[model samples]
Target: MTASPALRPSAFTDAELIGSGRRVAEIEAQALQSLARRVDGSFAAACRLILASHGRVVCTGMGKSGHVARKIAATLASTGTPAFYVHPGEAGHGDLGMITDKDVVLALSYSGESDEVLMLLPVFKRQGNAIVAVTGRAQSTLAREADVHLDVSVEVEACPLDLAPTSSTTASLAMGDALAVALLEARGFTADDFARSHPAGSLGRRLLLHITDVMHAGEDVPQVSEEATVSEALVEMSRKRLGMTAVVDAQGRLSGLFTDGDLRRMLDDTVLDLRNTRIGTLMTRNPKTIDARQLATEAARLMETHKISGLIVVDEERRPVGALNIHDLLRARVV
Candidate 1:
């Protein structure tokens, strides 16, 4: 005879689920706090080894530790520490060739007895390469063989089953960040250096892009002499398509600005003569201006704060050299 189906268990309440999550976070946070106090000479030695290495930092690990190892490698490389992750499982096949005497190997293991990683120790020894190990077991074979060992031992895992690697992995990741940051500081890595590596990112655009790079220079700039008629200024604005025109003095120095809104306000009058009206009579005096060499991000902020759509780039003598609008910033990917 067929057996009756087993009853399904009730789902956990929201309060119960949230409580479990909080408990896990608290445990992991406490583990990191404990790991902070254990930072000693060995950590410094690891940083020094990576900083002095002429070649890239080769990070390796197995399983969960391998994931954290990849992240550490990325952080190191991004912060000017030249690094790459090598999988121990793959190293035994052919990836071991990636490691060299000039490179430093950073290994991560919770038990410090990962056979895949331990198997590469002999190769590292034969090549005379330095090995920095981040592990929980200080007396494990991997730790004992390392040139520098960073202790990331945790008393308990955040896992309710007590078998998963939760707390230990967090500690290892924290230690990796500590190493990367220390090496970054030692190498004197700057924001400009970072921007160069991440030129496709928003931070790179903000830091490396100049106003002149995104502005319309030469004849593209809409402008009219202070004595030019309103009709002439409108024609220049229409031809340039910037929706605005700069009013300059006899010396070609910027004196005022006339925008499309200005024309609309002037048209509200009982009668207006665009051909006979001088631009300087109705232009806003002492308009906003920015230096050509300034950062494009600064231009964005200026436009935002002033609620204007365009700006005039000026030289040392306050002469109009270029003009730009919000659309230019958008096109340059600086917005």
Candidate 2:
């Protein structure tokens, strides 16, 4: 019997993989740097065109460029620019009706001579629509015909064979991002506005959700009067299932908070009896609280900073009006 050497899955050396990755990254980074230096009056003109347009910005491209254009449109739309992607191939097949003179057309092509994209230029010009071209060839038909041209030329493709649209696509996407971000800043787009565009996302929950939206209010809030015994507090805590009770003064204002941990501590004193102990004696005085109108993110931060899992929501008069715990925040996706 002979022993065999252990077999590995890969046929290529680690050095080969690392070298290819580094080369691609270096080429892309250099391309971005070059584009940044070349951005001039034309880039500003493109931004102003979109800002001044009375209708949506129509982004169009073909093949891989189309994919990048779609993403760019989404980023622009989410960041406050009214934009959408229209396939150049479909534009001549009746989708052309989607474009109007009031809208601006942003056409993207690596070679700047995509027949499908160029076919729509005449129609756009006839309708008095503004055209912004993003292309690698500065002198191509698309560039010459556009009202504004954003040059995204790359000296070489990240693809080793130089046949695939690798670095070209990266440059185009990055340039699109630059444009969208510049417009976003100029429009004074805020986080709240971004959240509105992404209402189903976690960012929306953090930005739009208030404590009152997720907190248990009214009778659902576990509470005990200052005169209540520890046993009575335990009943309220158990009934509410929050593991804690807000202890209020005779005027119904928040005086303190008592939690299961407090009960445990009281039990540790052999002389104390839960049934006979007053909750006021063992409750934590002036516990941390949040306003009902405060953002849920603030509540999450308060709970995290105070090393507690729950919070009592109070009114302007310092009266306990609601209750929430880490679980509530987790359920709301605010934590």
Overlapping backbone residue pairs in candidate 1 total: 0
Residue lDDT tens for model 1, 1-335:
65545445548799999999999999999999999999998888888887778998999999999999999999999999999999999998999888889999999999999999999999998998899998999999999999999999999999988899999999999998988888888888998898888888788898899998999999999999999999999999999999999999999999999999889987887477889989999999999999999999999999999999999999999899999999999998998
Full-model lDDT for every candidate? 0.93, 0.92
Looking at candidate 2, the ten consecutive residues that score lowest on lDDT are 1-10
Best candidate, TM-score: 2
For residue 198, give model 2's deviation from the true position in Å: 1.9
lDDT of 2 at 9: 55
TM-score of each: 0.88, 0.90
Candidate 1: 10-residue stretch with minimal lDDT: 1-10
Task: List model 2 lDDT by residue over 273-299, tens digit each.
Answer: 778889898899989999998889999
lDDT of 1 at 319: 91
lDDT of prediction 1: 0.93
